[model samples]
Target: MPVSSPQIINMGCRLNLAEGESIRALLAGRDTIVINSCAVTNEAVKQTRQAIRRARREKPDAELVVTGCAAQIDPASFAAMPEVNRVIGNAEKLKSEAWEAYDAVLVQDIMAVRETAPHLAASFSTHARAFVEVQNGCDHRCTFCAIPYGRGNSRSVPAGAVIDRVAALAANHGEVVLTGVDLTSYGPDLPGSPSLGQLVERILHHVPQLRRLRLSSLDGVEIDDRLFALLTQEPRLQPHVHLSLQAGDDMVLKRMKRRHGRAESVALVERLRAARPEIAIGADLIAGFPTEDEAMFANTRALIDDCDIVHAHIFPYSPRAGTPAARMPQVEPAIVKARAARLREAAAARRSRWLQSLIGSAQQVLVERPGDRGHAGNFAEVRVPPSETGEIVTVTIKAVQEGKLIA
Candidate 1:
């Protein structure tokens, strides 16, 4: 990749965005620039094409090398695009390269891990919080996902090394979030010395002045009594959990090849609530899978209502290339969009109810950004009298005002 005025572009989820930050740090202030690509859905792919066209229009002959899961899953398709000069995939771009090429090398040597030498938090995004990738890759075979194809088997960075990274971020007074493809499977490759829970405990014990510790999306299948107990014991850890529940209908769960079913997932939620009633639960819901019809959608809606989730990252089903669901007859685009809209509406209602319930209670709120003369917590954005940034203060929930709780 080569250009007179080069800039990096990233597309996809937080994980991909995190990787893009790492890549930018790898090639910061250089004449050459790297572009992180995405393959989340068909619409996303189209958006990527439009973005590439726009990038070319902005900077013709820019050193635009595309990487990430999108490039990994379908390199030739991306290679065919006119905007892309080079496509690297399958851990090939993990290494430092002076020259550009279309390459896909499946490298899984944790020992050969590409450290940007001085690992730094993403500079582009808001600095209120930072997420560090402690684990990479997946072992589960979800029918609709392209992640396993892009990322190989589970592997974790050494615990001491991870602590060092967290310490670096803490020194800058940034909140640290432990993230991964499947965080539950963290520390599997290494000899069973310390688990993800152990890592958190170590960080909490050592870094006493750390602002906050958060965890990424956790799988329900991995949750047990011990983990829930540990969560109750830790006061510094945020009470938000982003559990990915693809479907609430059992048959749909089978079709999606998800590990946990409706009943078990519900049980897990109940246990969490029992342990910590104030714990804010977050969830992901995918609507309009191949087997999902009106009744199935109703079941999903009811389940969401039952779960009483405060925040939802809802997505419509879209098949990616080389995945099992891609071969199956996809739900019509119109249906997918409609169900997705309904789910969003339901999620909004749930959040409103949760916020209403929080009124007349006190919460230890961390002032992230100065909003329209207010502040927000790990849960809802609460309006406050003028306060300094990074000020962690307690506020009594007064009422739900304009989609935010007033304190």
Candidate 2:
């Protein structure tokens, strides 16, 4: 019989991606196969099931364990699956003792938990850059969200712990990204209540050797002055911002319980660009939410231009059960899909223009793969001459082909 090393199938956000790396390190040298599932949407749950089945088929003799948000919210459903041998919750997945036990389910009350462990600092992963999770869970109760239930209330890792992790990872990885369920909501739960800005400033000041620092999706409202200043002025930080702007219409935003209005979001981006002309803008927009009329959708569509969103994440509104928005009147499925497509089309056009503008300009590309492929500081993929992997090099943009820059 061939010995099987643990195989981790990860799905979902950057935070989950980072956690998967930690899990992979934890379960090494074992004949177990793990599915690190996501539960952000109904579609995400469906994909988790698909991943589990596929994992089992590929490794029939290995013990199949399921963990992450999907398994945390409904462990019994995953436990009922014939292919699954064990199901662990989000909290238990990190604990060494949880892996030692052979219980059918090791899920605990996530809501009752208060703090998050700095798991990434201890793990070694083979990737172009490292992702360090500074926070986990959410406090906000958005009407269309089930993440809070799955992840529990917002909790932050201490700043000292985070700095230590980054300091260690920065020594090896060329770049490091800060990720969380609610990244901007960091610091409120910790002692002395140091803001995310404070943390970033401290990390930069303490770890001067860190080449590049990137941030995952951000809530536009939470970009305070300290954070905003660093975003505009800091050379070490990447020049890309992905906002969690779900909807562009004020009424739709009100219904979704979002904190920032459309104008506020537009203004924030405007200020960012005014300070730094080269920064790229990315946003997440949902189409055809409950009670959204055509005019409301038009507001959202027009926003793609207003914000100059070069990278867009368009999700056709799918109602998740037990959410407030799910209980309201939903738009037709066809209409939802159509609106989403239009958003993507608009974003692509904006991105094309933005990329074309970069022609003849110099960009620092972080080499990722074996050949000439790498991502720029603004997160644009570029092709350069064959360079050593994990090295950052300056390249002049030559042309755009198939949505990538060639140099």
Candidate 3:
């Protein structure tokens, strides 16, 4: 019988998606199954458990292993599951030896990991674009976040390693997106304290063949002046800025232990628009948090318009175990769901208007596998004429259909 190749089931953020590709390369030819789990929210953990059981039922004969943030934080619980044969930590998952002859449970103290494993840099996701894990972990202790404990402290992959990886990947892919747990918190842990902007500068400067570069979610407060200049002036960098703006009200932000408030987020968007009008704004907003009154939710709802957010990731408050938000006065579950729906409606309207605005303009879109669809530099989804896959083409927008721009 022909041996089946190993499979990697990814769950969670783009960082995990990127790491999953790396893990795939590592476990090549092995007849095992790996579930890259997430633990950002209570819902995420529950979903991870569901994925474990589902994977087990699909491939009952294969050895099932679990890894990623969920497994890193609580390995014993996953290992005890009847479906799982092995459990590994986030750090160990990247190393080659861990997969050779895995132990029943190999989770370690994540907080003690100071250096990023350099070998996991070059990973492939798609022919059109590639996601690179430039940074990992989080040092911030936001009241609602359990990710810090799961991912450990902030650590950066050195500039040289990252640039080398990008150069190699750029030879094939048209776009490269930098991803991390706390992306904006990059470089502080590195020698000479190279800022994320400096790293971008180096990547763009060195790898001239790279067509486009994009950044994952960022904390607005952490963006330095150098990064600001790049966002406003650099044409190679994609024109979409997705901020980690959790709340819009001052009191709510303070309660959540977030660094920036509503005004700061609005002002940052204003400044970005002033510098580059075509730049699209994206943000992550929690609908209802602990002690969030109707007025506070109103402020958050207004942020959709105030920030001109064209891309929004609206998450309802789901308290995770061991998080400070879980201990705080909780908002009613029904209220949280209602507010989340309102935020989504507001965001959809904003995005619809933004897409409509592009109806008359011409945009350079990078065609993906389907050849008829791709995203512009501003991250606007566009329906284009048939073109070569992985090739960049110019399209004249004629109208807006549903959520995509027709060309």
Superposed on all Cα atoms, the candidates' RMSDs to the truth, in angstroms, are 3.8, 1.3, 1.3
lDDT of each: 0.72, 0.90, 0.90
Better of 1 and 3 by TM-score: 3
Summarize candidate 1's per-residue lDDT along 1-407 as a digit string, tens digits: 54343466777666665666666666665555466766667777777777778887877856767777666776777778777777776466655562333343322332243322134344435445666778777878888887776666677777777777778777654467787877887766776745777778788877887878888888978765556666655777878777888778988899889988899888888888788776777888889988688898887887787777778888899887678888887789899999999999998998888888889988766666663233333557787666665566788888888788888
Higher-TM-score candidate among 2 and 3? Answer: 2
Candidate 3 lDDT by residue in tens digits, 1-407: 88678898889899988888888888888888999999977788999999999988988899999999999888989989999999989988988998886489998899999988465546574558888899999998999998988789999999998888899998888899999999998998888999999999999999999999999999999898999999999999989999999888999999999999889999999999999999999999998899999999999999999999999999999998898899999999999999999999999999998888888898989899778899999999888989987888988999998899999
Candidate 1: segments with Cα more than 4 A from true spot: 1-6, 31-33, 98-126, 369-377, 383-388, 396-402
**C-alpha positional error of residue 208 in candidate 3 after TM-score superposition, expressed in Å:** 0.7
Task: Put the candidates in TM-score order, highest first.
Answer: 2, 3, 1
Question: Candidate 3, which ten residues in sequence have the lowest lDDT sum?
Answer: 117-126
The candidate scoring highest on TM-score is: 2
Worst 10-residue lDDT window for candidate 1 reads 109-118
Residue 368, candidate 3: C-alpha displacement in angstroms: 1.8
Once fitted onto the true fold, the runs of candidate 3 whose alpha carbons sit more than 4 angstroms away are 1-3, 121-125
lDDT of 2 at 303: 91
What is the alpha-carbon lDDT of model 1 when measured against the actual structure? 0.72
